[model samples]
Target: MTTPENSTAPRPIKATGRFMLAHPAHIIAQGFGSGLSPVMPGTFGTLFAWLSYVVMTTRWPEIFTPLNWLVITAAGFVVGVWTCQVTGRHLRAPDHGSMVWDEIIAFWLVLVLVTPATLSSQFAAFLVFRFFDMVKPPPISYFDRHLKGGFGVMWDDIVAAFYTLLALALWRAI
Candidate 1:
């Protein structure tokens, strides 16, 4: 059956590059096309977060102070809420794997806490964060299953970031 033109029902979307560019929300929610990767789009989005965070902080060190990063990351989360919601509606999936803004913003938060370290340390953070995110142990898995809509899509990754931070803290203490 054909859906009504004005119906609020979400329609399945083919997440192509064309679709990614079709709307501003799509661009942001899709991690500027990094989410188009057929394999491990979330990892790609997190990589984009790492590279972009490094570039921005290195290129504009004065502006990307820890405080500024807090602000920027907070703003990104707020924006991701809206963009993910809108994009999710368009994609007909509350948390489409291709919508990686959650990963991007969440990883940005993770990196914000782990900077001023060696490249190896940063890579470790990447690996740990990816593991927590992919495995979704305990509370992360609980929230991921129960939470709904844009907030749900974005929040699980935040828990993964927390787990990453906790793991990093424990490693540092050891």
Candidate 2:
């Protein structure tokens, strides 16, 4: 039996192995594509945080003062919710990996106490903050799990920052 001209079989979709650029959540959630890295996207995202901190601490040290840090941390918590909700809706995905703004803000929160005037101290603080963030022990883990949306995305890192601050304080005291 001959098939009709309009009755051709549908072709199977072949995987193109191409990376996607325009996500529903806009560029922010994709960490400006930093989150799309093949490995350790979080680290890459944190680098952005480090650079931002360096700039802020250098150019606007007064804004990063102890009192300002508290204000910034609180602001981060509030804004994080809006950021997360926006990205979540954009990507149609809950807490997409590309949403690294939260990570940046959270790391900055941790560095508030230990932020050093010297480059070496800044580097040290960055490393320490990264370590604690990665480990996510105790309360950090609790926050990570219990919170939802942007708060959930950012909470663990915030707690990690607190832990790092405590450790740094104790270390300095010794």
Candidate 3:
């Protein structure tokens, strides 16, 4: 995967260790290759998270409880922190755009929290999430700028999820 001489797209994180499949960190940090897309990798990664969450819930309906989702989201965050750290070091890019575990796990949280909703509702959630993730509003922007390393990478998306969830809650109340 060679970048063109003048291509602005990010080269997929130094494909040295089994092309991002050999190591667990690389696989996760790359969002199972969803992050490898040259265009809107964050969007692709979040979509992957949405699809994955839907499939999981559909396949195992009993597993969609709030407690289960919280546990799963927490575990993903813990693992994401370590993997993001490793992958960032391996790529030598502190916050590579292609490293999208932040989007994947963060969006997973959104989908899980908003379960049992209509497709339109889900779409609205997705759009709101993408907007906050992309624009990085207020505290989100502050964390994205002020934090460092893997924590910084994941913090902004978590904040985005908060904003998205807040919006969805208000919409639900109306």
All-Cα superposition RMSD per candidate: 4.1, 8.8, 5.2
Clashing pairs in 3: none
Model 1 agreement with the true structure over 1-174: per-residue lDDT tens digits: 555887776568878999888889999999999999999999999999989988998999999987899899899999999999999898888889999999988888888788456688889999999999999999999999999888999999999999998999899889
Flag regions of model 1 displaced more than 4 Å. Answer: 1-11
lDDT of 3 at 70: 77
Model 2, position 155: C-alpha lDDT score:
73
Residue 170 lDDT in candidate 1: 92
lDDT (Cα, tens digit) per residue for candidate 2, span 1-174: 547566555532211112224433345544556565667767777787777777877799877776886787688678767766776655555566656767777766766666454667667767877788778788887887788877688777777777777787777789
> How far is 154's C-alpha from truth in model 2 (Å)?
1.6
Ranking by lDDT: 1, 3, 2
Model 3: per-residue Cα lDDT over 21-113, one tens digit each? 867898999898888887898999889888887788788879766579778888888888888888888787778877889998888788777
lDDT of each: 0.90, 0.67, 0.84
User: RMSD to the native, candidate 2?
Assistant: 8.8
How far does residue 136 in candidate 1 sit from its true spot (Å)? 0.4
